[model samples]
Target: MNIRTMPVVAVLAFAASCSAFAADSIKIGVSGPYTGGSSPMGASMRDGVRLAAAEINAKGGILGRKIELVERDDQAQNDRGVQVAQELINKEHVVATVGYINTGVSLASQRFYEEARIPVINNVSTGSLVTKQFLPPEFPDNYIFRNAANDTIQSAMIVREAIDVNKYTKVAILADSTNYGQLGREDLEKALAAKNIKPVAVEKFNVKDVDMTAQLLKAKEAGAQAILTYAIGPELAQIANGMEKLGWKVPMIGSWTLSMANFIDNAGKNGEGARMPQTFIQEPNTPKRKAFIAAYQQAYNPPNGRIPSPVSAAQGYDSMYILAAAIKQAGDTDGVKIRQALENLQEKVDGVVTTYDHPYTHDDHEAITMNMVVMGQVKDGHVVYANAADKANAVREKASGKAKK
Candidate 1:
């Protein structure tokens, strides 16, 4: 109950006095950075998972077994993620694990799950290669699945908004030095290359670094029309704040991390007009979304009534339901059976993000795609639909959850 420095959570404590129920409970691992700069995304993701697990447990649970979440705070560090992965797999003996907010941590830690055939659904991490690490032919059997939109989809959308919509000819790339940033930067470059455009300036900075004057000045000198970013919340705020200091104002287009509360709150009005691709916004465009928003608001009572990272929370919520459906379909908690069931889900999971119907396949592990993503712009204080049409058509699109393009 005491929310301390790292916010360690042992969610979903069921009736422990009942020895039979305790033995019948299903153990699942939830790993992410519950503290530090990345906590906005990580904590939001874990909370969403908690909501889903509580709902499932209340409804006679999955396969009549209560869902027990074994939580771990990875602290947004790669080495810590590796250690957590091992503990979750070995000591905790989790059937499946969910939540990986950082790409570097996902890459470093997911291998242990792969080795154990334990399903690890990356609820937040969007590195292009996160799901491709254990593809067929190379590894025969793969254990990774992702519900979040990958960098390939996000980078392409970022370029489309930058080049096609805004018609910006000269842009600058500023990405963090972490695996998430560098890999996303590469994806952005590839996306730009497809349009035969190269950035005027490409700069890199480390996480928690406040000063971005050097990077912004270089982009300013190059007459860059906009700044393309691939980084997390806190540092991203610095870019906007730094630009204000140099009196250089330009459109900030970047990955979904631009929507994080840390960036939006820290950058203040400076963060306004920033655009990024998002799978789920805070808006309740559908019935499921309305209920989710209301439930999350009532349970967490987050500041300003906004989930810290709405996309992360929504995707995390959907991932839990999807995984639960797989467990039920598999008729057992065996890791291999759950993995097989996930590859071919029989039921339609009515999730906050989308109505997932057989969302994954043996050949493809990614559940969300580019068509499900829409450009969200920071206006006033929160993210709003960049185009009203996207919101108007949300119900029909989400109902089917099919790829249009």
Candidate 2:
């Protein structure tokens, strides 16, 4: 869909930006799956990046150079992501990059950026190893950074939600065979072990697998009180639907992917009560969130006015600002300088997800922490705060300058 409307203020600001933009613009790469099952997260992330770029460009961009986004669809494949990374780095000559929806894609691809000394901000991919690909004693500097909540945080939250919150002692783990799923599954196991518990049943499936009957039957036979998941949207929906077919329903607690629109719509009533940790729910709790939601609605005019992946969009939006802040602080588009600026950002970023204050450092490239996430549950086709207390806490956090939008 076309942009429904552009705010008059933005129109004027963008018009002013035109003259400030030189013929050579600051190239930033946007790489993700714009098609296929993972499209919801990828597309939402791209849209958020687009929104942020527009706003930045409207304000005459960073360092008085218009921000130019070079987008490519990796189709959620590892090899494709590698190729996309190389193209962006070598061919397009992008100073920095953002957007990696799949953990496998980020793992397979981000090495190129490290080798080239180009900064790559992972806005969606949450694999714990993503930012640790290069460390001291081996690689002098790291170029890979992330704004998404890593699997370590998610697995802990999932286990806590199932065991501590819901009181489910016997939980089943259903994870896809992909790197994202397997790595997350391992993290879940560790989290469970920490709680002095083991999964009643562990099941694995492929990417496009539709029938989860075998997995569900095994979980049911094992007397699992809940199903912990580690997969993307469509397959997660299959698990919910599979339970429906078996006439047995158990609470589904998993990663942020459970908030995907595909699962919510595909699972329908069956998807209700599913909970996951979210960096940004689609609620207009803070001023930044309200403006972001309204801007997204006006720009893309998405179906149902619901972002396919709220977490993806918010993180992607924030990633752009983070990169821009670094660029502005450095006063140059040099990759190495940009990376250094990212590690020690003097300016606090006012973003849709949260207010970033010293979000990164030389030893830590992860921008998100456990406190930044909250449990969100599916309710009548939308993700809402699982606990009323979380909603209040979120608002309070925003007011306190720790969170917003």
Candidate 3:
């Protein structure tokens, strides 16, 4: 009999065989906004995770089981994220999960993992409360850990850069209506308050808002020298475009979301010189970074050889390695054991971002700190170090801290 005309029972048997073969592999859920405005960050992060998983599996797999990613697109919606999280935990039976590029999604989705005791490594989500949702007082053990620089650190850096470095006294705060943007706006306000400075005008906008005329007008009327933003890329691009239309050009300093490809590409010339804190710039400064860039390029050929969102990609790559190390240390895929191992990682994990040494503990789940971050700028369609002095100072501080340790 021709294979194409196989019997129905034979086809079903072949499909069952494939499903059983897949079940033998260790499953990891990868959830993010893979097909929406946030796709730049989400897709880059997913690509980074895939790269690390491929590398790990090539080396005899992790704990003798091949790693398989069960990806789900959250579409940057809170309810969709919750559904994806439940499906990943219950149906997919993923031992652990990684990839949450949107803060709103992270906050809405991570509860399922906490309830199920499944470990989750948030690779790109920078919400301050993402990992703090379940603490010792509330819960016996927290199952969520993040590798990205949280909004607290990013907000402080942004305030410092605007006031201290650029000498902008009258700044305006522009944030979105989402939970991430609103919470980040509060953080920015607190950071400014610490310096005894208040924003000239505080404005809010919704996601996918094309016109930022009112927001820009308010800031311009308030004589704001710079604009501090907390929204994602598409809306951020609108801010830049609106500024250009109004013939008002001010420094756009904001969170790391400003480094997204969507913002840079959409804003075009208006997006140039925009600054933000970055955990990783794709400059190949270190040997590890060089190798990672080369590998990512080889695996996924991005535009102009750029890794789309460098910060997201690097954090995602490092997060996977950290998870692999924890899984290796635990010697099993048990969620509780994995959580314990992550809280106290024994070996040094040389990742694309930095050499993680005791990155987490019982009280702290933040892996990347302020010292490991540097100011990055959008220049010539790419993100680069904003200034040599800032980069050098951060490097020295990181090195000094490591020496003391």
Which lDDT tens digits does candidate 1 get at residues 1-405? 211111212232432322234766898999999999999999999989887887777677898888888889999999999999999899979999999999999999999999999999999999999999998788988899999999999999999999999999999999999999999999999999999999999999999898999999999999999999999999999999999999889999999999999999999999999999999889987878887887777667899898999999998888999999999999999999999999999899888877887788888898887778889999987998999998876632322234455
- Tens-digit lDDT track of model 2 for 1-405: 112245645533543454365568998999999999999999999989888888877677788878878889999999999999999999989999999999999999999999999999999999889999899989989999999889999999999999997898899999999999999999999999999999999999999999999999999999999999999999999999999999999899999999999999999999999999998889988777888898888766778999999999999989999999999999899999999999999998888778888778888898888887899999999999998877776622222244443
Which regions of candidate 3 are displaced past 4 Å?
1-21, 389-405
Count of backbone clashes, every candidate in sequence: 0, 1, 0
Cα deviation at 97, candidate 1, in Å, is: 0.3
Candidate whose TM-score is highest: 1
TM-score of each: 0.94, 0.94, 0.92
Give the CA lDDT, 0 to 100, for residue 392 in model 3.
48
The alpha-carbon deviation from the true structure for residue 26 of candidate 3, after best TM-score superposition, in angstroms, is 1.0
Name every residue pair that clashes in candidate 1. Answer: none
- Give the number of colliding residue pairs in candidate 3: 0
Q: If the candidates were sorted by their TM-score against the true structure, best first, what order would they fall in?
A: 1, 2, 3
Error of 3 at 171 (Å): 0.4
* Residue 368 accuracy (lDDT) in model 2: 82
* Candidate that beats the other on lDDT, 1 or 3, i.e. the better one: 1
